[model samples]
Target: MILTTKSQFQSLIFTGTNGEYIAHYSHWSLRSVFQPIFGHNNILVGLEALVRIEDVHGESIRPDLFFSSTDISIKDKVNIDKLSRVIHIRNFAISEYKNLKLFLNILPSVSEYFALSDINTCLLSNRLKELQIDRSQIVMEIVELNANNEYLFVEAIKRLSQAGYCIAIDDFGACASTIERVKSIQPDIIKLDRGLLLEHFSGESNRLLEGIKMARALGAQIIVEGIETKEHLQAMETLDLDMFQGFYLATPQPILSCISNAV
Candidate 1:
């Protein structure tokens, strides 16, 4: 069943036959900040919801460290992912930029938890419908930490795609997966890893251009992440990237209206 209460922030507590699952927003000191994704002419096309956590003293907790420090069980990770989505949808529902697409990150392995009879899947689907968030507008960015289970990942992508959510391969170039993996999944979008732009590889520009072309030819859009300077932006201009996201364009913020000022 679905139950929620407001402490310091709204806490969504979902219980299934399995046991109690708590999305403790206040308990975890969790918040979601959105980074705007821009297309041609500096037009805002989407926003990626990034989770931020703070300590008791209101000190910021790095997301990576937060996850690493907590329980890494698949169930716990899935619960946190669900909580993030709920908050993002709730925030986006109240925002003026409802038309813009919302990109939500998901662990590639988390998909394995979403069986056909999964209660969490049902809850998530119901929540999305309740919020009136179109599935087409929500891009599920699959973060590839391990690529050994190609079959599992492919199956998960299929399920998500069939449910009408656009799939994206996040941190594409830096992932363990190869172009063969990209061809196998054929996601709706592929985000170039920030490392590719930060550390110059031999013929990095040419390599990126080729990569962009390859993704486009496969019917996927290319988004270059971490474009933090004019040089970065200028360097990508020649590649005809479908979208760009980085601190140079706009830092992740709590409000969508603030994005206009930043951009």
Candidate 2:
């Protein structure tokens, strides 16, 4: 008897009828939730697409767990990343908030694949066009997890930036190598890790302030994540941070027709 759980089933890589290795998540019931990024005066400047997956039983599965449970090979990981981007763009196109910029997370490894050739560039551009999304409206947020190949990662970011996609270094301060990454990639935006806010109450603002200054010096806009409380908002009010996203301002949800439906 083959005992298969949903996580296990979703992790299995199989050869499709077309003789290509298909990522399990590509066929899974996946949807995207948009989290609004606010600028000064609480104006909505952009929306970040957060992916959600549902099990066969209709239960919500956390994305982190979904990805971590799957021992996906590098190739399949790249394929899954591409599929997720397509889904996000498709959903954004059909939604009423198509006017705002859409932020999409891309794994550094997957980005390297995109940097490999002009064909890949055209492929993504065509995909966005098919969904009526402009390439310029997409902000590629490169996730730094296991981004060991600095040379490849930097080159990939350069290629993508040249192709007109705004590059952002996601989860800054989450690791020590982030500073070097910021210097090398020179991303258009730097998102401070949510962990920094946890330390704000302890009166440790030096590091956070320094990070903001460094990003500004590099000609990058600063965005702070995880602002869930009024105190958190107060703590960040004096900073030069350009954008904010978290539970306090708004939470991730499907963009409904009316403004009152926002989370």
Candidate 3:
């Protein structure tokens, strides 16, 4: 294992096959945020990006401490850069395992996606081809959607779909246009938000169920997020969700290690 024991929590930077860096931190005291989900039977699966901080005594820090910040610009830039690098890394890892799919988190603003000109695309595509990764398995998870520009979002989604890239509406059930955008864009994947699962009372269950059914009918797959327990997993099963992600499974780890272990 390339992991090192240092402070209470140790952070290791994993270099992607594409030369990007992903910093992974884990603490031995608890379930660190850097866990990767396994499909069916521990066959290395998707990873959830998470953060863990340590104190002087090496105890793992609480999640709230890290997320309570109010800096908008810093948050946005970090998200944009992180997603781009992760995708490049995944592209490199896929050379060895052609069946693996890469799920990348995307910001809502289309402008946030790094603009790829013809030249950029050519270079990147060449790199991916060398790694044996097809454009189809790369799924981009758009973090949020609203009713503001249903038509425009749908158009953007269609263009991406036409290019063989899969479109996923992340945090689906948290916004007003959940139904409208799903109907319009027809995303390949619809990810349920943790808020919906946490805040829903008796009255909201039926509506959530309807949303999932509507998405499925429109030819989109359903993936529930924020699952933290067996109860959440069982509830998702009751709802007939196709896939799920959250603490119940595993958190995101360095892509390099996940790839190495898969072999």
Candidate 4:
């Protein structure tokens, strides 16, 4: 097994997949891939953890569909979400990119799990300590939350931040992830959604630019995602954006291979 933690192995959260650690949930196999985030002048600043899923027969599964499907129970979602973060942190802790921030996504629907469990959150903190990784190098990015789960989401984010991890509000301006979320969560970073970027290119007013201004005023660093073209990046350069991510720069790749190359 790639995992060294005795408790991790005992819980069966991970198993070796061709020398790389991967999570298993229900009938699907889960793996971690990292997409690099760049700053001005294409400087690599951070990496985002994205989950890749495969069915038992080895067919590729779209992660977005898997995550958004209502068929999966909330309990299962919570387990998979926790497993994803664990695997990403494990892979990152042993890699050359350990110096860069690792952005891990949190599903809002499962926010109650974190909101209610100090023991579980403490285990995560302990894992970081065992790996000799700095808490500040981790960024917990929470996705959009609906009204019903908003309070718990805030509590979860606060718990993580209080434990020394940086907080980020993911997919701002999409779904329910609105400006109100930014105010309530008060995240360290605000990730502008790609949809807003596309809207900008269509001459649909600079709402994305306005968002950057608002986030900056709130003392939050801005990361413009979906810079799919030179023009898109150019638009961001005109603003005071802090980081960028999209296909134009690089695509997500298996964490094992990425860290190997970096080594």
The top-ranked prediction according to lDDT is: 4
Q: Per-residue CA lDDT of candidate 4, range 168-192, in tens?
A: 9888999877888888888899999
TM-score of each: 0.82, 0.83, 0.64, 0.90
Candidate 1 regions exceeding 4 Å error are: 1-27, 55-57, 68-71, 115-121, 147-149, 199-203
Check candidate 4 and list the clashing pairs. none
Give the candidate number with the greatest TM-score.
4
lDDT of 3 by residue, 55-169 (tens): 4477765533332335434443343334343444443363443366666554444422333223135433454566666767667666663422445555656766777777788
2 versus 4: better lDDT goes to: 4
Q: Which pairs, if any, clash in model 3? A: 8-58, 35-251
Global lDDT of each candidate:
0.72, 0.72, 0.54, 0.79
Off by over 4 Å in 2: 1-27, 55-59, 68-70, 119-121, 257-260
Q: Lowest summed-lDDT stretch of 10 residues in model 1? A: 1-10
RMSD versus native structure for model 3 = 8.6
Of the two candidates 2 and 3, the one with more favorable lDDT, higher being better, is 2
Give the per-residue lDDT of model 1 (tens digit) for 1-263: 22222332243534323231223443455566789999999999999988876666878877656554445454555556667776777777777777889998876656654433443356666677877878899898877566336686777778778888898988877655457668877899999888777654345565566667789799899899989999889888777788999999999987544766786
The root-mean-square deviation over C-alpha atoms between each candidate and the true structure, in angstroms, is 6.0, 7.1, 8.6, 3.5
Candidates arranged by TM-score, highest first: 4, 2, 1, 3
* lDDT over C-alpha atoms for residue 28 of model 2: 59
Candidates 2 and 4 compared by TM-score, better number = 4
Clashes of each: 0, 0, 2, 0
Instruction: Give the C-alpha miss distance for residue 23 in model 3, angstroms.
Output: 8.8
Error of 2 at 244 (Å): 0.8
